[model samples]
Target: MVTFLLGFTLSVLQPVTGLRGFDTPNDAGGNITLTWESPDSGKVMVEIFRSQSPLEGYQKVESVLSSRREFVDTSAIDGIKYYYYVVSIGEDGKTDRSEILGPVSSAPQWFNTKRWNVLIILILLIIIFFIFIRLAKKGTKTYIRKIPGLEALDDAVGRSTEMGKPILYVPGLWGLTNVTVLASLSILRRVAKKTADYGARILIPNAEPLVMTATQEVVKEAYLEAGRPDLYNERDIFFVTADQFGYAAGCDGIIVRERPGAIFLLGVFAAESLILAETGNSIGAIQIAGTTSTLQLPFFVASCDYTLIGEEMLAAASYLSKEPVMLGSLKGEDFAKIIVSLLIIVGTVLATLGFTRIIELLSTG
Candidate 1:
């Protein structure tokens, strides 16, 4: 009973287990190295756990080598962040865990806010609000900004019309619910108007059925807005298979048969990103792609001509239509970034000086 109790005490202290040598390399394979001195004379195996994100649940990996003093992880994906922890198991089959040490992530982050973060957020909101008000009062050239990617649509549509072919606009997998999806749909509206104006054909191949319906509304509205309602075609903006690869295959088939001059892939995409872009590339179509999903970002960078990363995709929306809300949001985001930058600098200085106040603040407040 006494030995059992000691094991139990060690288990309870998992959150505070004293250890050392925790570091992570976010680039490449997203590996992290964990090493520590086993309590002298303690015959026990160490264990590790990891999670894809902070909010996710932890999962056990494997025990640390008994003879060795280190464990290096190689299973994590590049770009995405992961969390890690260590544990020790005793000879009697008793177990104890160390505190979670790492949350190594390669993906770039905009901010890390705590305590005074709220103040910084408020400052950003105010800045954005005022920018919009100022722009409205001045009747500024902010009337409408032009994104280069969006500007290409007219040329793509005209070329398609001249060749007696259709233009392919893929709103991606995120239906109309995602803000990026909505932005992509807004661009779809412009594409519809341009195609209608030149008497060209436009096809919206949607992976989500819901996007199929939304694209219909967006295209029809664009035609009505352009005073060419007769040019709209319901069959053009239709659903493809929902499976990512299946959708890519169907669209690839369409490209080979119909031969769209330009292909716009906006909003979310995943593993099938390169496949679709390569397909479009093979058929000699001008492709413009944008996405916020970090996992698939590299593929877009490699395959597409214009790839919008991080908040650039958001900025593209305002660039397209000059919406006050988006512009204001951008101002807010900038202030938020400034606040985050200041906090990072201050935190580094404080942490180096061993000031526990901020840690306490993070914990309690």
Candidate 2:
């Protein structure tokens, strides 16, 4: 009876109670906050444990002073339910555990409110794009500034015709996946049609086989569209080497032998740009060059008779084709740029005046 009474007294000396855990608020998930009230008995430390389920294995996560009542468990996985309990150790080395507070599962939010500014800006741009497209379809005119390189196409082809020499067009060394190459092809259609109308030969030496096939198709279509299908020659549009300098050397050989009166270099180019440009210059060819490669722009500007810089290369298609949809899209892009500029200026001024609401509103994060 005395032994049983002594065990009962020891159990009463150390006890743990009042444990609770819940999902963290205002979070992207994978977090839980736990809280418990310490027992009336004096304690030294409290240890936290987690388990997938209350009836299964439990792993120690953290240990805190007994005076602390709360802990945040950030290691929990999203969409997983977890159970947590705490063990309190007393000054006398006695230990007790609280009841497992459980079944809390972290969940991720579908949308992040932090990027609201990005969503708003994207929606605005989309609205602008569609608005201009609709306006253009209604026969509304969109004004585009004259691009000199694009405007001189007719004269360039005319010069080739008068000289009775082939017109050389290079679509650069890049593949069909490049936007610059696609733009070059669009311009080629126009150039091919002009050449067909004048009955002048047009030579296109490609660095990629796929681009050569595409160029041939585009040239043939242009000839057909010009009502001169009889003059279209598939042999004139052919593939050269894919090697950068090899293609440049082949083009230089053509410039030396065939001596094309007019050369059009339009697409993505690299170090070989100057090689071809300088060779065409030495051969007295009237070279009109356009590329998105900024590194090669200075060489083209120095060697070619006319150069289309940056956006002008992209604008050449819409300018030459005069398609309302493309023109409208270009106009819309300019309008959006103006809007962004204005917003930046306004935001800057407001920020300097200690009004940060506008700046904060535009921040993506």
Error of 2 at 177 (Å): 1.2
lDDT of each candidate versus the true structure = 0.72, 0.89
Model 2 misplaced regions, further than 4 Å:
1-51, 57-110
lDDT (Cα, tens digit) per residue for candidate 2, span 1-365: 99998866664634456677887765798889897777655678888999997987999999988778789899999888898888878777877877888888887676677887888888999899889988998998777889889888889999989999999999999999999999999999999999999999999999999999999999999999999999999998888899999999998888899999999999999999999999999989899999998899999999999999998988778889888889888888988999999999999999999998987798876
lDDT of 1 by residue, 265-357 (tens): 888888888888888888888788888889988887788767777566767656665666666555556666777688778877897899967
Q: After TM-score superposition, what is the CA distance of residue 191 in candidate 2 from its true location, in Å?
A: 0.6
Query: Against the true structure, what is each candidate's TM-score?
Result: 0.62, 0.79
Q: State each model's C-alpha RMSD to the native.
A: 14.1, 6.4
Top candidate on lDDT is 2
